[model samples]
Target: MRAAGIPQGTLAAGQERSAGIEAPRGMEEDSGRVKISDIRVKHIDRELDPPFDAAWDPVPRTSFEATLVFVETDTGLTGVGSGDTMAGFAAHAHHFIGEDPLRMVRHVETIESINFHAGRFWPLEVALWDIVGQACGQSVATLFGGTAERLPVYASCGDLKSPDARAESAIALRAEGFRAMKIRIDPRRADEGVAAVRAVRDAVGSDLDIMVDLNQAWRPAGDITRSIDVPAARLIAERLLELDVLWLEEPLKGDDRQGLVDLRRSTGMRVAGGEMAQTFADSLALLQADAYDVYQSDVVLAAGMHRSRQLAELARMRNRSFTPHTWSNGIGLLANLHVAAGVGAGPYLEYPYDPPGWTPERRDFMLAEPLRIDGDGCLPVPQAPGLGIVLDPELR
Candidate 1:
């Protein structure tokens, strides 16, 4: 379960693995004084051979794209983050070029401001935290409070499949050490989706915790099609209720506060969503309205690590689960992972995996090698300085 920066020795549960690891060699004694020297962006694309047919997306995804953000310090320390495209960021890159890399609060605020006028470049904040962890000689998880060193992860399957196929996959994932798995259900194919869940339930019974994703939270770019209406979602949800699913994700629109409440109450299930809320206020509105039992806001996509910690804590205060949606690349997963482990985010984190089309190899194409889940189906937080992102040297 160890990644690049994990120590060689065995670590007791919840122990901080980066306790004594120093900053990289040649780094200054006073790494705290390091200033941001440069911020470089790298675009890497891996053409998918089989083409991923995710249930949420109509078109078969033929390739995977990763946008890598590197934050270099004057002290020769370079922390990396990968997530959304840094479009229009270069025009405003100078805002952070010469500033202190450890000024995480300031950088997060700046990125949010730029997000209003440019893009949601929260990965920059992730890069900054990576630098801050390195400067202080600690992993980001330790800096985020080190509540726990590991968190249970669920296999997040993307593609839509037949009942038998999905059931077979579920059994295999359970055998491979995954304690839970999330199955995506297309809004258009509601009946078949419920059938898939039933099949999985019949196959694994209580051996696996099942989660269902309706993917009605928000539509992707250029997707004009409206999501399923409330009645339709409720209909499908009623069917899934029989299978004893752990949680039902994105069963309604992000802004449909009343509808979400109705669904949760009517179905008597743990409703989850808020991953792609248009803004922070939107998530607050949903939370304030008591729309969800579980908050799946992604650290990278929804908000940077700092703000996401706020959301997770707030959700915890309300007795709501805070396992986030980590559909982005491996770095994005790590960013979310640190915060989840740091805050003791419950029950299960998302680990995207669907063989032949989507796998760890494609999700973590930026890393030198893919990160492996532990034997117990838990994802151990990286113990390395910074995010511990070791990019492939050949990726120019």
Candidate 2:
């Protein structure tokens, strides 16, 4: 039942347990320990604003931003991580400020205890992993025992008004060297989604790989009224398959494990989800149910580097693709980059590449040097120790 390198056991050894249990082998020693030195959280706000426009979901939006969390070890090495929701970051500061950064597994559990009380402690966990990797003089990927440095990247476009517009954007992204692209589909109408796929496929031709994300996995209901379940998801999937989509992401509610399994079997398109899955148990359950072909673990949501890596390992063992979701911001993208790099080759890295909305400058405003896509569509595995990134002093 233990997924992601976490040891599952009862809180107590039980009354019948004998003294000769022998302290669980490695538990007897606290060797090679490193303590947490400092914790810094930055709330970043971007200058450039972008709109979120799609035929189905037309909501006004501006700025691509996120919260950057840094966990430093006593040895002066630091690790960087990011998250989307920064609502309760202050409350969890005490839980991470003085613990052993190297004991990522222990650190994640301690934070989980605090999470039960206040909720959402994954981002802080990510920062600790960065700290641990730096303390050990390795990239987060190498820390997880992954062999490869570079992984194939796919452009994750945000939103566009028309199918033609989306196609144009895809063409531009392809020119920049992306071999694969994932376009956002109109969740309201199946035909609009179909048109978007057709236009992009025609624009990129049959040679380029494409994926479509429904973003319909979870819809926030503004009122007390029940959330509307869109029946058009199935139809959209059918059309996408005809257009030769590599995969369909978040086609239905994420909690619908049976539905996802059935959808994958029914359509034969790789069903992908798990970006918002908040814990190891949630991911384990999904994997056990055979809910998805690709497991999209987000560093911001998986609660940190240790848990994320653990999820990646689980996915690898199951022969499932582990691609960390990178939509929060630049730091979130970089954090996942380390995790993806560590996962080795095969899975395509998610690169949030919708220009005017998620451009490199606005997305990575805090970093001294933004992580850029190479001419061949691959992002270089950061060579510097730890996360291989530093905050821009100007942003400080």
Candidate 3:
């Protein structure tokens, strides 16, 4: 069976490219199409000089790891993407070998089934979309629908700092062109987190829109700890409301749809979650229940580009927001960007950054140039063909 939102036909036909731009030479056969020749995965590891104290992690991240996927066509054109470990995918590689890369709808169906029985291989979908964009001589965002040229960015800080330190950091971000910032609230240290939010609000006043993340959806590996009860979460929501928070993200578990709805209704604050819902079906449930004011799902992690486009549109039709959670490497983030920008979803998109720990340079070490917000604090959607990815030449 086919998943919802994916169109019925294939991208192999009725294709169009940007004006004046041309697809690579000799990329088509008698069929006027190219077949997937190979799918390769590379594991990249980079060590952090000063370990990163990620709010969600039980311990500091000493090194950064990325799984880069390369999908090559018979025409010698290759598309790249990065995300999950792609473990157990080697056994499933035969699924896409020697098939038309343009049969994206079919490929998306196959991958969705594999995801239920095997592991997540959506990055391959990202790579295939990358190939389709290059074949069309347009950016994937354009292929997805070219809705907006750029989107505003929010500094998604991952580390926890003292109230004073965090307030100082907020000031720095405001000075450096950040119009908004997200502070991760530790469930265990709810009071401390509230204090930090209060401090930042006092420091920045109304210049920057502040978002708070509860990080309660999924726990770190080996974390058997229980999530905060609804009563506790509700109390925290009340506290954050006074601080003028833009949104309270993941204040409850991903499955707590009713709790999320109730919290949003009671507290009157925008609730955002579902970043890792694992499927379009799961997210649809949340959207249907009116559980959140803003829906966030990483395209690479949960909904592939096709499904994400549909999800974003559905959210808009429902008068809800669709800003995705983009905390992965640059490629993964770009995947989210193309889909989000293509569908015009958001008042702000997540841009992971926290100085001296997680920076654009470290998050995008695989790219030739790290993506940064411009002087106006907008993340420009790459107009170049494909996802506009440029791998670092020195990165072997």
Candidate 4:
């Protein structure tokens, strides 16, 4: 079915790029007339040097895996995306075999349905955006209605470091031009988490804004779970507030809507979460419950740019802060960056930077060039067409 409001010929048919390139299986001479000819998924695994400590995970993470997706049009203009493994999309590929890439309204409906029966099809939606941008000859950020080419950034760390070590890291992050940094809280030991935040505050000396993440989103399988009761979360928030943490993230279970709201109200601290929410409807529920002061939803994991844009607007309408949680990988980060830039009014963006394990070099291994922050501690939204990422064959 066609998406309503996208008039025929709106995506005019013709060559989007330099002419004379050989077309693939399903091409028409009109560039706007494109079809999904093929789709492929790849898996990349890399071993960490010192086994990173995933704060929320039950076990130490010694390695990391990336799931890359490629969606090709009949004209041979391909778009790339990365996110959670598309476990069973191969079997359901028939649903989008010859579909229009720009009909995002229809595509979003298709994705929501596909996710219910088989795999999480959100990443495919990202690929669709990539294709649409290329076809329209504009950057994804521009497509999302953003004018700024750069967005403010904050360093985000995943490993659990000792107080002294974290202090050193915070100092270094400041030197790297970051105005802010986020500390991962050890779910197993709340005291250690509190101490780590205190150390960073002492080291930074009130120069850097610190956000603490409790990572109460998801846990690994077979791990003994620690329930963070309302009182427990309250006590921790009190301690972090004393240390002057700017925000507390995911202190309680993500679905505990009332509890999250209560934590924000009682502590008077900015509470952030919603990166794990599955749909815009789910986010609406969180908003209706006043669950957080800040809403962070990843486009790749949540519903894709179309839904994320709506969420961004909703957050603005509610007078709450909105930023994307971008820890997945470089591609995932780029997707959110465009959305955040498109939404505008964002004060900062998450820049995953846990050295020796989750560095930008490792996170962006597949990209032709790794994304880096400028002297102003901001990443310029890529101006290139599509997702603006070129795949590195060596890394693949």
- How does each model score on TM-score? 0.90, 0.87, 0.91, 0.89
> Per-residue alpha-carbon lDDT of model 3 for 139-180, expressed as tens digits?
998887788888899999999999999999999999999999
lDDT string for model 2 (65-122, tens) is 5677767777676676777565676766776666667656666777777766775767
With candidate 1 superimposed using the best TM-score fit, by how many Å does residue 309's alpha carbon deviate from the native?
A: 0.1
Q: What tens digits encode model 4's per-residue C-alpha lDDT throughout 1-396?
A: 333554455443662433333334543345567788988888887777778766666677777888888888898888888877888888888888787777777788888888877766777888888999899889988988865789988999988888889999999989989989999886568888788898999888889999999887555557657558788889999998898888988888889998887788888988998987877888889888989888898888876778888888888898988898898888999998988887883668999997865788888877878899998889888888888977787744
Q: Higher-TM-score candidate among 1 and 2?
A: 1
The lDDT, on a scale of 0 to 1, for candidate 2 is 0.73
Query: Candidates 2 and 3: which is better by TM-score?
Result: 3
TM-score of model 1 vs. true structure: 0.90
Lowest summed lDDT across 10 adjacent residues in model 4 is found at 15-24
lDDT winner: 3
Error of 3 at 358 (Å): 0.5
lDDT of 1 by residue, 1-396 (tens): 554666566567766656566434433345557788999998889998888888777688899888888889899888888777888789989999878887677778788888888888988888888888888889999988898888889999998889999999999899889999999888788888889999999999999999999888778778877777778988887788788888999987778899999888887888998887646777788789999999877878887788878888889899998888899999999999998888888799899987856888898887888977999999888898877777777873
RMSD of 2: 5.0
Clashes of each: 0, 5, 0, 6
Please give the lDDT score at residue 269 for candidate 1.
Answer: 81
Candidate 3 residues lying further than 4 Å off, grouped into runs, are 1-30
The CA-based lDDT of model 3 is what?
A: 0.88
